[model samples]
Target chain A: MSPEAQEFLHTFVSESFYYWASVFMLLIHAGFLAYEGGASRVKNVLATMVKNLITLASVGLAFFFFGWWVYNAFPLFPMAGPILGPWTNPEASEAIKAAMPYVEGSYPWSSALGPNNADHMTGVFFFAFALFAMTTASIMSGALIERVKIGAYVFLSIILGGFTWLVAAAWGWNYFGWLFAKMGYHDFGCSGILHATAAFFTLGVLLNLGPRVGKYDPQGKPRQIMPHNLPLTMVGLLLIFIGFYAFLAACVIFLPGYEGETTIYGTPVTLASIGVSTTLALAAGLVGAYISAKADPFYTISGGLAGIISAAGGMDIYHPAVVMLIAFVGAFLMPKVAMFVERMGVDDAVGAIAVHGWCGVFGAVVVGVAAGGFPQGEGIPAINLGTQILGVVLFAGLLGFLPGYGCSWVMKRFDLLRVSPEEEVAGLDLADLGVPGYPEYATYEYVNEQLPVAQSSGSTKYAE
Target chain B: MQFSPLLAIFNPSPFQTHSEFLEVEGPFYTFAHQPGMIAFLLILCALGSIYFVYASFFIKGEQAGLKSPLALSLLLALGLGAVAERVYQQTLRQSDRPTSAVTRGVQMRSPQAPSPRLKPLALLGLVGGSAAASRRRRSSASRQRRIR
Candidate 1:
């Protein structure tokens, strides 16, 4: 084939690859829609679904306007001058230079952001990243459902999706990122950068947002608020598991002329490795959750997500067996971590903090231990335990927790963070949406009778 | 020089680069450019729809003595209006043939030329009309029940 012909073919393939990946990533939102809806009591189902849907729209726009730019601009933030990667003089590459946030086309108003014949990769790539941003925002959505104000949630989603997690990505997930270059931070699938950051952020929000009114008894003992539809929730989880394949695939960069796949950090990797490890980790997580939670359907399905996250950071290099082991341990410990969070008086409607945050930290830290002394890239530090631990602390604390807590705290002070107690008890669907997810089922007298007696008692047993 | 009235109405050239002129581009290029605009416009429409949906809820919440912030709803509506105006202006500029000032001026002066200012007003009218119709239907239904 002519060189130009080959180049065109390569560009087409690369563009189509990310395009399909973005399409598959849409399933994650679909899953979240069902998952949260099923998890919510019937009164709150539509409210739950609305929040999930709104996360996609709000985060998507925010990512296009600023999130992509932040990823490009801040790789060397808090420092000046370019940090050299394998591609010496990174600015020499047109693609890299055009993508730089300081560059004209990378900005929102740039023609490159609009329609241009010369660019095939930017739009598709931007879409993939936008989906990632939406996913990050959605991670926090489930945790604050039922009681959260939609307006407040939108504000939080924009900051987390468009700004904070991207900061973590620029610092850790990029090839020239400071964390990667100086400290050998290796989060190939963004366990630390995306999942942990969002999870910790959710934790911060939950701290300020408080728990559901009937989540606990007067003795400070936790009461189980069962999902309205266990089967639907499990099915939703399975869809998320499917979408996760695309998530991992998007992490691998397929350069047109390059021989094999590479991590975002430019380390050699293979799609086969990612596929195998992810599947094994998923299976391990299910088994672990099933055994540990004693076949509790909710925790078992949640374990599947927790498992993938646990091994995601090191899946590029870890053997399938090692992936399984890590996944199992993470899944097994998930219920315990969730219980601990509950003990602290926080109400996480879904176990997002445990699944994403704790497991993401475990995945990231395990990479330092398991993949220690591995060379990251040319001129970058080798993977080690200390840097991984530091990455977790920094990602969870500064990037994740602080903004989450600070924003939510301000919202709380203004009484804007949560719905009114009356609104909460009456259900967000009727109070906020003026519609119910299951209008027919919601009106059934028997369903109301079946609800926990504690809900109708108006007891302040759990109130602080 | 004269431009097609259809060009003014459709505004198909918003994304076409200066070099490309009227030449049809490759499939991917055409597809890429087309969807980006469609998606943007669709998102704006969806946002507008969501705002109206929530606005009704906010009013209801206030009527129920809940502290719903009407200011936030107004801010969102204003933001959407500004974005819609910018998009409309960009489309108008692109659709106006670049070589002929006379054509641009003529199109600008034409009474049929679409105005960006009408978008928000049109949106409000549509939403308000639907809301009023629903209110009437509800009141009549309640009156019939009272009579029964």
Candidate 2:
């Protein structure tokens, strides 16, 4: 084939591959919405889905307008400096322009519009990465399900999806990034940078938002928030794991370098190696989480996903046996963490804090032990246990937990966090959407007749 | 564990004792495999597992899915089989066959082009679909409550 043809084929195939992969990833959102909605009682489901649906739309625009740029420029750029300097420069190279969003014209797709190029492939590449930002933001939506104002949470997603994650990705995820080059940190696919960060962010909001009314008894005992629909939540989690494969693959450079052969098995760099690790890790996690639970549907399904995320950073190098062990550990811990949080009076509506935050933290730290070190060699911050802890502390604590909790705390001071007692029992949906989901049957009477009081705290009613 | 006394009689260490059984490879396994099989298997496994979990958990009522499970299992098996074959090919083969061309060609390659935005357009579709989902969920719940 002509060099030109090869280039075209490469560009066409890469672009197409990414485009379709992104479509599969998109299934995760629909699954998340359905699962979260089901986990939520009907009174609040419509509202919950609304929060999830608009998060993508609102956060998408936020990411387009500015989010994608932050990932490219923030690594070395001082935070206090001008945000647009590196990203929006009109003089950027063609390769850079070819990689951005909202370009109507061509070449050097202005930093304003994101880069563009004939030979370069930045637009879709940016999107491939951008998909992660969206997912990370969505992770938080479930935790703050019932009473968070739709507008407030949607706007929060813009910060998480468009700004915060991009900064962290730029700082930690970049190959030549300052943190990577100088600190010796190695997070293959953002166990700390993405999942852990988002999880803590959700916790911050929940802390300020407070637990759902009656989440604790008069004696402050915790109650179980059984899923309104178990099947949906489990399905949602599985879709998340499937989407994770694309998310993982997008981060890896599978193609051979110039003038070298791609190795497999004994030769090394085999695609099968990656596959085996991923599958075994997932299977192990599923088994581990299931065994721990006496047929607990929610935990078992979530365990499978926790399995993958835990192994992700190290999957590139781990043996299949080791990967499974790590996965099981990741999955089994989520429910335990959830129970701990409940005991502490922290109301996490979904297990986001455990599934994403706590497990994400473990995954990052585990890489140091399991891989024995990062693939990148020395001077990188990730090799040391302290640095991994630092990454988690910064991403999950300083950025996510502290800010989230502080902001939520301030919001709570004005009684903005919780709804009225009547509304709490009544639900956030009716208050926010101006529509009651149930019409003819008296709401409480019907709930009382059908479900036990413990199962009947349907706290949002916009669906009516 | 009750068989431990029998096992202790056989060997002092278990980790180093795999020699008790003869070593052999699966018939289909080989080391010349590339990313094509791996990538293919990854796709099949991902989709299949998703289907299995989805049906097992979410699908309810009379419309319980039948085809999905079979389809999923087949996809999963094919993916696993291909991946296993590829792994064996990589590990057992000792040739310096310049495998990059094969693997890269199979799974990925150098930069040439990027596909245009299906996403921006898809976002429009999502917007429309989500609107419909919101309304449908509401009305269905109301209808159920009314019947009750």
Each prediction's RMSD to truth: 25.7, 16.8
Candidate 2: regions farther than 4 A off: A77-120, A254-272, A374-382, A413-418, A435-464, B1-148
- Tell me which residue pairs clash in candidate 1: none
lDDT of 2 by residue, A285-370 (tens): 77555544434677778777788888876565555545665676677556656666766788888788878887799898766544
Backbone clashes for every candidate come to: 0, 38
User: Chain A TM-score for model 2, please?
Assistant: 0.84
- Real contacts recovered, all predictions: 0.00, 0.00
Best by DockQ, which number?
2
Off by over 4 Å in 1: A80-104, A442-464, B1-148
Q: Kindly state the fnat score of candidate 1.
A: 0.00
Cα lDDT of model 2 overall?
Answer: 0.60
